[model samples]
Target: MNATQRTNERPGIEKNRIIRIENGKKAYLPLLLLADEQEDMIDRYLERGEMFVLEDGDRALAGVVVSDEGDGVLEIKNLAVIPAHQKKGLGRRMIGFIADRYRDRFHTLLVGTGDSPMTVPFYEKCGFARSHVVKDFFLDNYDHPIIEDGVRLRDMIYFKKSI
Candidate 1:
């Protein structure tokens, strides 16, 4: 589908809808940064990845970027919900949308995130189980230390769920 094409799938909400952003995905960088903090890191996959945004009218409430990682694996490159709309199930809704949309095409949904109190529990709540860890991923990759919820992020904790 083109950039303007929107999916009819709704996450149990009438006004909010998910749309595939085929072009100009960087326009939502602010939202994307909420999940993946560094721009350079995002650039690694943003262009090749498929982006989806949850919108309430013209305002975007959340966004997710997914990439085909071969071997029937779809990795969530990034996912973020606006602070005002977070903790209100928008993130979960976005995940549900992705899982449902890719169920037939992919067998597993994967995500790598910092081992922060703020994120680990969230992914667990979304039905993801701890898979593996990439040692010192944040320290080795990011330009500087990434701190979340007063804890310095070190390893990249990977999570997976069967689609």
Candidate 2:
């Protein structure tokens, strides 16, 4: 089936639906980049992974990409909610949806994000504990420096939650 064809498989369950995208990762680029700023960095995992979009009726509110990172682990490569829909419990719901959907397939769910005042707390609140940190990750990986909440992002902080 095409990417848009299988969107509303469960119509009566809830208005907020999470649809898995098997192709066309680029179509959700604008939202994806909100979570991970660099386009080229996203390219490394976008097509090789699976994508999901959270939609409320006809409106797309958030998107996420997860990839099998080997050793029975699934990593969330990117997750972003539309600015207008932020802080509405949509992101936590999406994370819960992904965890439930992949629990039987993977032992754990991992998400790597930058060390930022704005992002780290949110992930921690989502039940993810800090597993490790990659020093100078953003400075070394991306072509340009990344800053969030007025602080320069220099480390890649990894968080994990067992499913």
lDDT of each: 0.92, 0.89
RMSD of 1: 6.9
Provide the global lDDT of candidate 1 against the true structure.
0.92
lDDT of 1 by residue, 53-101 (tens): 9989778999999999999999999999999998999989999999999
TM-score of predicted structure 2: 0.89
> Which parts of model 2 have CA positions greater than 4 angstroms off?
1-14
Best by lDDT: 1
Residue-level lDDT of model 2, residues 1-163, one tens digit each, is 8768787566575787789888776988899889988899999999899899997786779998999999989999998999999998988988999988989989998998888877889899999999999999998999987879888889899999999
- TM of each candidate vs. truth: 0.90, 0.89
Whole-model alpha-carbon lDDT for candidate 2: 0.89
